[model samples]
Target: MNFLLHCCPVHHVMVLLFTTMVAMEFGQGCTQITTCVPGQPMINCSVVTHDSNSDPPIQITSYVLENIPPNSVIYCLNDSAFFDTPGTVTYAASSDFTINDAINAVLLIRSPNREADDQITGRVTAFDTPDQSEANLQVIIIDVNEFPPEFIAPDVLQHSLRFTEGERPTNSLVGRIQTSDVDIEDSESTVSFRIKGNGGDEFNVTRMTVGPISFSNLLYTYDSPLDRERIAFYQLTIVAVDSISPVMTSNPSLQVNITIDDINDNAPQFMGDHMFFIPEGLEEGVFVGNVSASDPDAGENATITYSIASSTFDREFTIDSTSGILRTSSFYKDLRFADNMRRLTVEVMAEDNGVVPLNNRSVFTVVVQRPVRFTNNIYMFELVENNNPLVTVGNVSASSPDLVSFYYHIESPGSDKFTIDRNTGKITVQESLDRETSPMEMFIIAAVYSNHSDLSSTAIVRIIVIDVNDNSP
Candidate 1:
């Protein structure tokens, strides 16, 4: 902040001057202080000391001065002047230094100049009052971080250009980001100045000489902010060498990422061989020729999605989402189909789903399916006991490419009491059959099938009955 003096310093001193003094208070051994101007009846001040027994109020009861004679006069007020239970006394700073509740003598403060400095000497006289003493207590006010730079505009990153001592004109708000640490503006601690990245005119950092600068500035403004892009990118090497033991520092720089964009303005052209003939009479779901195009734009705009140009395929075919392969979704008759011509020319196109900068289009020609067969094959199956029945058998490695469904049925000798699963082909016996009646069981066909009602397959099982009991032994 700039200031205008109301009057000259020499003239201001002539206005008026005054003097003041301190005194011990009243009440038993306790002391109080009162102020008095220069000629205003110089009330002779006196000091005294006493403990709790004396009533008046005093907590700490002892203190030591430069006890040596000619320097100070010490005395202990004989009475007992103790403070409250908390042993506290009002208007009292700390109870640590005192002589038996003794107070100090009154002190006189002198006025000053633009710069204020003063020296004082005194006798303890009484421990009751420190106001008369030379040892002093001072309070310091801290500063905050809020000052706006004296230079209205902080240096912005020079993204558009590079910096060279003589390359461009001087005073060019050279690549600099200005900021401040001195807060509590309007105070002496707050010193604002226009900031220029090159260490500013105030001082240039030849070797990081600290101490001289306000500790506030040095301790706080350690890191300088930078606009990476505008200045293109900066490789600032900051080496912090501390004087303290185990001093260490890091001289690090950074490589910023910057991507330049391209202009879209160009129309997408076609890619790959253009000509290909497909057999006539194409049907839905046919794969044919693939076509694609690309953009010169960056990011999403550069990525190309496909579609059959509407101008060409008002309603023609579909294109693969990823492969760009084109295919017919509907049947189309050959323009020459009237003369047994089964081929028709239809266009398929691709379109992009670019969120921005509009969509790009491409087209392709495809062949459709005519007539094709997809025969079914049998999967291997295994036989298993139904557990509910004496035995069960399931499909096990058997099949045929026939239209007929697998008509699984029991062909065992006890067919009336046996059945098999149509799908799993697990054959099971319904009743407990006595194999002894027919000691040698043969031709127990457990399954039958016909893929096309014309195709068939079968399997049989034979069991050898054994007698466990002997009659004549």
Candidate 2:
């Protein structure tokens, strides 16, 4: 029995030694370790040591791909595992690393976390080559603190905000402040916001927390009514704090300046008393004195538009909307027959273009003086015989600014071939003219007001009747 036990123990030892040799051959073929960034694709097999003298966190570290064997295919073992990558990242496996390609490929690693799996495990297998072997790959992932939270659209740094006074409602959204932490998305890399300055009570700011993979945004709202006259602007400081405990103190802060926009609270006012003098029979489109006023508001709120609110004469004058220039649009008429002081009153109003408009009205008394005698006296015309005889020949235009209405008549010795209208002074052919009878005709046309005898003017109208083929020769 003792001899049998010895033989059995020897056989068992042989079996154990054979198993150990096979395991060593499989796992220990070539256990090569190389460091690389997480999202980065190429595996640098070169032996490189960190330099404590230079800046520690550098973007790229050199890798010697020439040491890797030929006909070798690289395999990433963590295909099914999840890992953190900064920004949008992609991976590629290549046999030969060129100088340009290696530099570009190194940037794709994104923000790799050193605390996590800094080095990835992979396998390099060779085919159809002597010393064909399977080797272990160790890739070190490099961590870079390159990303900081940034303000999104409506960059608070570049833009200024405005709110109308007494018009904005409470809790109204004034502006939105947003920030993003792009690199190494994790609990330690999260960002938060807070407002940390004066005027905090005037406005309310709310922080909206986002997920680990997203960003943070803040909503700023007006909490009360603002009086621009009392306080026109507000200055506040905002700070962005990261989730990193000690690092939060080193984050960024922003100073915001908000302006309160003005509203139209005061009406336009006339400067002086109302009465002025203008002579009767003044020409149309004549510039009257300008009406001046002032406004307490700013920008367009101070702009005034002048209008003729009421006038004894209908549509007799026009006022400029911008320049406040008042001009006559029609001939001036005397009102002395009514037993008054020959005076005219017009109501002028001024309005401001503001968020809410304000207006003021003022009365203007214009004293009418005696008009000068009419000076325009002569008018001439020519008519074609074949033209529609009922159509008007030309109007006998005369200067009589003081007369509201006038009568026109041909004086004695005037030919009955043409007649003048009593009101419009328009002359028409009473009958078809025969140039053969009177080739040239002369008439004295008189324009006089029926009510006022002094307002009268006469013109010598010479008519040339051209001969046409109307007569059968």
Candidate 3:
């Protein structure tokens, strides 16, 4: 005869019952035998779960059985479960198959010496029945490998590194990448480091092993020279990867920032050669022109100042320390030459405000020309007292060695009666002149360059008015 078992759930408790019975027997009174008999007890259980290397024992409900006669008992066939290693799985209970007055069992799973088995099986039996029934109990130990790699030393996550440009050589240690894994039992997991993102090509990482420990160091490869003027700061990502079947990288990444400090490696250079023109006799402190320079460095290394390093004339010019504007000094009035044309060569220096102070020099050529001069110092003329207005008095002339045009004007007293042509230098009487009221009219004539009023010369002229009277007595 065949017997069938069925499982039922009641209030979080699982109960297994033998539904079909084969034969029956009576013990009291007459000896009677029937086709029906007591069925064997049945046991049913769920798989118990636990972590491979964790603290605290796992607790699960004990198996419940039905179809058992009176005075029957339930117990485990063996004390431990069978797996790759013995004694890894064990169970604890109070009295009989109850724990803390409840039908719960405590399962203890020790830390595995090596890779642990996925599951372990044990046998549970119900005795004292017509025929004993056995069932299998399973315990699954899950491998705990959940932590990702992390950077510890130098703490790239909190701080950055700084280096002076051209100070360090290739293969120099930039920083050490110290890392650890909380799942220390997982000896199979190995961590490797690498560089990523911009400026990563200029650096490299190397892993080294000392004894049973391994670590990585970030190095300055110098594949491309560092220039603070070209690029001042660089940001690179440091990634730590573990050698698991499915690799795991560091979360949020380790950002390694590097700042290149500036040095006075570049010299101040003039923007271009400067040339200027200034007429003679200009007052001191006249602005000539600007002389500019620039530096590509940062901070004080780029601050530039200008100065007159050398000049053909002493104390002839001055320059601004910060603005680089060139100005004339005391020698401005004495710049004229006998040939009426003179050039001054000035050497200007542009220096940066560094500790060592790098500098550059440039030459500036300034042309100074003499003022216009009159041909005669004085001129005498006579005019009739009753001469008509707009009559020609006399002609005065001046010349410039530079061949520039001239402008003429009267500068002395009694100049209102006479007018001079600015371009032609011709003097004329604007109104009739009287010898009785003003016998002699003395005035000064001034000539200046058309473009440069500062370059000028002066001359004297005397006009005598003859008396011619027509008496109307």
Please give the clash total of every predicted structure, in order: 47, 3, 4
Off by over 4 Å in 2: 1-138, 142-173, 179-262, 266-357, 361-473
User: What lDDT would candidate 3 get against the real structure?
Assistant: 0.63
Q: Which candidate achieves the best lDDT against the true structure? A: 3
lDDT of candidate 1? 0.33
Per-residue lDDT over 56-83 for candidate 2, one digit per residue giving the tens place of the 0 to 100 score: 2111222222123432322222211111
What TM-score should be assigned to candidate 3? 0.49
lDDT (C-alpha, whole model) for all candidates:
0.33, 0.52, 0.63
Give Cα distance to truth, residue 462, candidate 3, Å. Answer: 31
Between 1 and 2, whose TM-score is larger?
A: 2
Per-model TM against the reference: 0.24, 0.31, 0.49
lDDT of 1 by residue, 343-445 (tens): 3344434343345445544333332222212122322223222224556533333443322245555454646765656666555556544434545444434
Between which residue pairs do clashes occur in model 2? Answer: 35-140, 36-140, 118-141
The candidates, ranked best first by TM-score, are 3, 2, 1
